[model samples]
Target: MAKNSGRSRTGRGASTEPARKPLWRRIVRGVLVWGAALSLLGAIFLGTAVFFTMRELPDYTTLMKSQTGQMIVVRDRDGRELVSLGPSYGKWLSYADIPPIMAKALVSVEDRRFYDHPGIDALGLARAVYVSLTTDRRARATSTITQQLARNIFLNNSRSWTRKAREAVLALALERKFGKDQILELYLNKVYFGGGAYGVDAASRKFFGHPGTELSTAEAAIIAGLVKAPSNYSPTADVEAAIGRGRVVLGLMVRENVISQSEADEIDFSKVTVAKEKGQDSVRYFTDWALPQLDMLLPENKEPIEVWTTLDRRMQDAATKAIDGNAPKGTQGALVSLDRDGAVLAMVGGTDYVNSNYNRATSALRQPGSAWKLFVYLAALEAGYKPDDRVVDEPVTIDGWSPKNDGRNFAGEIDVRTAFAYSKNTIAAQLGNEVGFGTVAAMARRFGITTQINTKPAMVLGTSEVRLVDMTRAFAAVSAGGTSVEPYGILKVTTTSGELLYEHKSAQGQVLVPRYVAAGITDLLQTAVATGTGRAAQIGRPVAGKTGTTSSNKDGWFLGFSSGITTGVWMGRDDARPVGGLSGGHAPARAFAQYMRVAVARRPVEPFDTELKLPDWQLEPDDEQLQGEPGEYSYYDENGNLVHPDGVPGQDELPRYEDGSVGPGPGPGGVPPGVPIAPDYGPPGAAPPAANRELLDRATGRSVDDPGLRPGQGAVIPVPRVTPIPRATLRPPAGQQP
Candidate 1:
């Protein structure tokens, strides 16, 4: 019984004790399982990177020889380089011809262990991490030359580790496909070297004016330094900074033992020809305008070609200076100048192309204000109206819309020519209604106004939106003796070998108006420049232009031309807000004068048209002796005081009509003592209309030009009101009859 109990106790103790666990199962198996899980995660990550980075790699072979990658050079009319677009590349350099020292310099600075790394430099990464941990300076991480090439060729420089992993995978792929030297060759040929130069060959040519094959140690170091921060290290940006970077590169080369310290010190960076950064070319305004038209001219021609344009660099500079100096701040200004043949000589789109690239000259559409009167007068001339004919400047309603003069200062019974020169809004409205509004729109369209013209009474005051180019082009037609012209920029497109691709053929649009009509128009415009609203636009020469100020001064424009040259200037806010006290004769006309002075300085002073009665330059009548003034063009001076041209007699010098029909002068603040500005024909052989009889009876018991006339007064909206003056009765009031 004792033995049985002892055995049972031992058995129970043995059963109670657990089996001894194996150390291999507890540690090795667990480690293997965790390692497998980690490996699976890494596989998934690598697979995703491969799919994203390698999904569609560019055909590098095709890119190497692609015409699309070639640069196009644009030349001014003088054959000087205006701009260069597309990838700037030089001669393709193979690895065999590359200098060992050049490669060493780049390797020393950009990638120290470039040759030893399989694809990614782990040692470099570890060293970078160690430096980061130990010092305030942080070394560059894992973007080796190969990795940079991969990213440059296939991936974007997105600031993320995800992109880094993709860059790493691409680097591995590139290394597997190309040998180290071949990889270096591709990298040297594809990397951006700043200043719009891409690749080592271009960089070498840009910085040294020599090919990559002729690079010296200093130049090579300078080029190598650009890989990190091209703009910062570019000698063009700051020569001192660039040379310092080059010195650092040289030091790195010396440390790598690729070159001795003496050899590094012997390098002179002073001789390095740093390319100038094209910060902003005022000519860029013209180039920007012309570049896009190239695609349309030769859509199929993509080879590297030289575009010889019609831009006169002199005029471009003048235009830019005029706009920058004169245009008020917060207001955008634009100018366009055309040669006699309608070749665009100069264009200033805005104050600075760098700040705002919007080409206001061609793109912006705004109201032309009184400048729209050109079309009104042209339409009237086409409808058998003569400049010297009599036209009453009186307020009448069109569908209950009444047109008022600039300051309600209507010159009643003035000659058509005088009224037009004065920019009498009521007369213009009368003429617009006399000739159908559709006729005015047709005239505008015939003269290159491609915008939609609203054929309404309001069209007379230029309520329609029109581009500056449209106005310039329209005026160019008048400058061309009425033959319409299409403004052209690209004169010819030829390859470097002089292979003709495209040449501008003078496709004259059409003869918009007769030469006599053009001469009459010139006569009126000259009068305007002489004693009218555009007096500020005169530049000691025979210049003719119209001034247009929109209601509320939202837009100001001066479209004028001299012999063989026509230009347009516009000043306004882009948002269509009012420029306080803005007038077409103010900033816009001043800018026009400034630009045109330079543009015409060298050219001979010529009349607008030899046959046209241009303003008599010698007519300097004494202001006191200038008696019986029929009318005068008026404008507000810089001081905001309403004034007239020098020696242009005011209302006090007013004359009387011969037909005994007298009313008021066109001077500011209507004067109504009954002074006739021109000879009036006897009243029309018909009873006067209700409105006409009332106005005529009040104007001068003389009578109406046409009692049946219902010439609608085209209202310029938001007219500035005038002070009401006490009317002097035509007949003596009850006892004062003359």
Candidate 2:
């Protein structure tokens, strides 16, 4: 019994020992799994680093050779570049090619340990990390100059973790592939210096009007400051801020031992001379207008080429000064100056492009108002109406609608010149009807009114929308002796390397009006400027123009042409609401006068084309011959069909003459007994017509110019109120004519 008890105790102990074994084995397995996971993670990290390091950087040669870039170069008429555009695809240069002070300033501002590190410094990384975590910004990460260059050249400027990783990898790769000098050269050459200038060479030339190697310490420091934000630090872009930034750069140069402390301190950054040509050509107006022309120049590839335009730099500067200095408060203005051939010389779309890019000179379309009257008078002249012809300005109504003059009253009698000089709406409306509204509209289109023109009779009163550029171009046609030419800004385009790829010569189309007629029109417009609405536009030279003001005076425009240039100025609120009391002859005219004063200062005073001298009669249309009842042309009604109401016979019939003796007018049934009476042709309900059957027969084929026919001759045509045919009247109440 003792032996059996001992054996059972041993088996129990053995079974209990298995629990300890299981605990130890589980611990060992857990440790092994953890170790394997750690090894795999380490491999992944190493593999990632290796992959990035092995990736090749983008080649600089290829970047320059690629055809998907733009380099906009703006030049003056004298072929001096006002500015150059260099956003991408720019060349690379060496640090030595840049001013030494600039090199030191960049190192001082960006990477203080640039020369010490291969690509990135560990200390910088740590500091950057701490700053990033605290400041909540990605730029807190410190990238050496080499690393920054690598990122700029090979990686995008995205502030992301993936991009960061790639940037580090590329930086390391760049250090490994290139020598320190080569890396510095690439960075200097590839860095952007803002204001559309790229690379050390281009930037140096842009900012200093000289080579990079020759920049002074102050200028070099300013250029260095541009590395962070070129637009923000450009002296021309932000003078005070750029100067302040330059001081910071100079301070860094002192700390970096680039220059003596005294030299850095003595640097007179207070008056850091801003490079005149550093900023763009102030060609905001031309830039907008020349875009479409550029598209044609480079139709195949979208690569932007440098354009050399006919812009006069001095003139552009004068224009900017004039517009900014004299523009009235609370009012916006636009000025466009194009040469006689339609080459834009200077254009200021607004007083300032930085305030708003909404180009008022080219984009805004306001009512031409009286400026459109030029076409009105031009059409009248074309239709055999003389400038000296007499037209009564009494109250006139066309189909129950009466148009008022500017002040709602008419002058009794005035020649066409006087009527036009005073802008008599009644007389102009009369002339429009005589010439036909469609004829005036067609003439307007020919003279460059691209928008829809109202063919309604009110169109004679200048109620149509037209863009400033189109208006300028149309007026330019007048200045160019009636030969219409497309307005152009770019005269030539060349590659940055001096390849003449495109050139624009003068493009002329058909003669819109006869040369003598053009001369006559010019003379009349000159008269307008000298003594009438455009008197304010009178410079020392002969000028021709018209002023336009919409109803309630919301928008005002003055468009004029000198012997050498044509300019258009418009002033208005953006909302198109009524300004209520302004006249086109006032503000817009003053602006024109201001701009022209500056323009004529440099130009030689020249008279208009005197070769086409006019005999007194040549300027006026002939009045001896009748202009053929002013032919009532067919026009579509709302339904788009032709109808002549006066020609169509209604159901009402005439009374039978009864052996050619007069009798009471017939009724609707056409009998002499119980003749139906017609209403009188006076005030709403005064007429008691005896169904005047004789009136209808007498009105048949009556010429509008028939002298014997008095007012209210033709029967009122019952068609829509499109034409101004007079209402029918009874035969002077029975015996006045006999």
Candidate 3:
């Protein structure tokens, strides 16, 4: 009876102790049960949400059919993009064309489970969720390559839960519709790689100057790193930061076993050469000039096409440097270079195209200044004026208008060759008068000067306005041995799909000037460069050109050519104001020389086709003249002054015939007959000698021998001794005036 009672008491005590358990234990058990219930409900909710998201998603076919904007690319002769017009859409590259390393690097860095996952990686998502829950931070991205592609192609970059859900659904759809390789190719060809580049192919070309198939491991890694944030990792914008990102990619590549550790280490990031972002604005000048001709070249309904131009990238760069380096501040300039066939190799329309889109090279109709003299001289050559034909360079008036030299100083008795070389305005004006202004204008038109020219005498000095391209084309005609050239920029235009739209078949034109005439003109121009105003433009090779400065120094020009290429450079104010007295010889000529040196560096040296031909008088007299022949001896000093063989009169002195005799005879000092001598001799206050007085009357057209002299005029007395007098003090005989 006692043992039974003890057992009952022990049992009662144990039950009472259990009923007195800690409060914390009961609270934890209740909370866990509630947490389990909530978790189960959340799972159901998520599953339902994903199902609805997938149902509402667009068809994969619809997504694939969506097209982006098209591009109109302008490639150089070598198929390099000089300028790309329209939207930035790169050419579609297939999976086979992309380098395998590029794909491996992208997968290693962007998504490690790219091939195994069906749009989403369950393990990656679980890891991301576990990390977020443990650290109490925002969830990290576990987006697979497929999900990122979906977000890129189908959805906007919004961080909302709805967008994320949509991205996952679209990614699953993409995986179901396309193979792994196809999706990757789509990603590569669709991703934005900054700097207006749209695809990996474009990005590769933009940053590496080559196609994706040629990418080295380092280059592939560099491009893969740009996927995260293109602008931040652009090699051209910040090379060091870009290289740092590239190293990270290479490290990731090694860890993923996509590349060996040794391979990553062997990569020299410093050796990677990033192609500079081409200045679209800089090449717009050429495009602007070339666009208008596209319609004429192709049919009206032509599709988007690629225009292959004649531009040589190297020459264009050289031309730009030449013009920008030499052009003065606050002034504008233009440069145009063309081949012998009239293919424009380089065209710089203005100094800064961003500041002004006005293409000065082809559009600006500024005065060509002395460049117009080319046609005038060309006309004179056609009119049978020998290069050595002498013309008086003294002051003259025509219709009460006078044209003065640059310094208002005249060079007396200059031949046509020397006159053109020295750019003597007076001689050009006289020749223009003699050849008829209409004839000169016609010659200019025939030489490819389409601009309207004023028939006035001032036109000989290039007062009329003309386009730089027109002048360049005209100069190209001379370089081509008188064949007219119509400057063209487009070489061919073809559709992106390889359909031929338009092709340039160089049209042959008639020869406006005779080949011999062009050659003769070329000879004179060569002399101009050797010893005349265009001396500054010599490029160590045979070059012929002209230098022209307009009145008031408003415009300056240097139009010249090599055997294969002809270029024209012009400098002046846009407002037609003086360019601070910058003459053609100072800046324009220098710029021409600078450009031609680099442009023709690869071409062989060539000389002018014709040799210089001088007149009989210009040749050195033979031994007979050395014997002091009465009427055959004459010589000119450096200053072009006529002197006796004995050298009595220096360059500063003038020889005068006595009594102003109009007949050819040997007078004192063996002075040649029909030559007028200085009448004003000795000091300013001194009187003329009796023989000099009669000679002065004959020179004034008052002698009986003078046709204009009075009918009853008596003949002069015996001839007086010849004397040397100062050239400045020598006056035209009384009846003779310049």
Q: Candidate 1 — which residues are off by over 4 angstroms?
A: 1-63, 66-75, 79-87, 90-104, 107-187, 204-217, 229-241, 252-260, 268-276, 280-288, 300-308, 492-502, 610-738
Ranking by TM-score: 2, 1, 3
| Candidate maximizing lDDT | 3
Best by TM-score: 2
lDDT tens per residue, model 3, 508-623 = 96787766678879988888999999999999999999998887788889999986899999988889887786889889999999999989999999988864343322322453
What C-alpha RMSD separates each model from the true structure?
15.7, 12.4, 18.3
Clashes of each: 3, 7, 8
Backbone clashes, candidate 3: 8
Model 2, 300-393: lDDT tens digits are 6444466788777777777776567645565667778878877888888877666677888888878878888888888777544556656677
Runs off by more than 4 Å, candidate 3: 1-93, 108-176, 214-218, 247-288, 295-308, 328-330, 350-358, 380-390, 411-414, 433-439, 493-502, 516-520, 540-542, 601-738
- Model 1: lDDT to the true structure: 0.76
TM-score of 3: 0.65
Q: Can you give the lDDT of residue 119 in candidate 1?
A: 84
**TM-score, each model?**
0.65, 0.67, 0.65
lDDT of 1 by residue, 1-738 (tens): 435555554454556668978998889888999999999999898767655555455455754544325577788889976777787766668888877778888889888888888789999889899999999997768589988887786678898988887788988766665689888888787789887777888788677667799887888888889988998988777889889998999999999999999998788878777766555766787888888897789867655678899998888888988888878779989999999888999998988788888999999989999999998998776544567756677776655558888887766677768877789888787777665555566678778887766655777898888999989998888888889888889989887557898989887567777776788788888888888999999999899889999999999999999857899999999999988978999888999999898888878987766353322221113421443232333433333333444423355544445566544555686445443222121232211111222342333211223222222345222221222111231112244222
**Which stretch of 10 consecutive residues in model 2 shows the poorest summed lDDT?**
725-734
Could you tell me the C-alpha RMSD of candidate 3 in Å?
Answer: 18.3
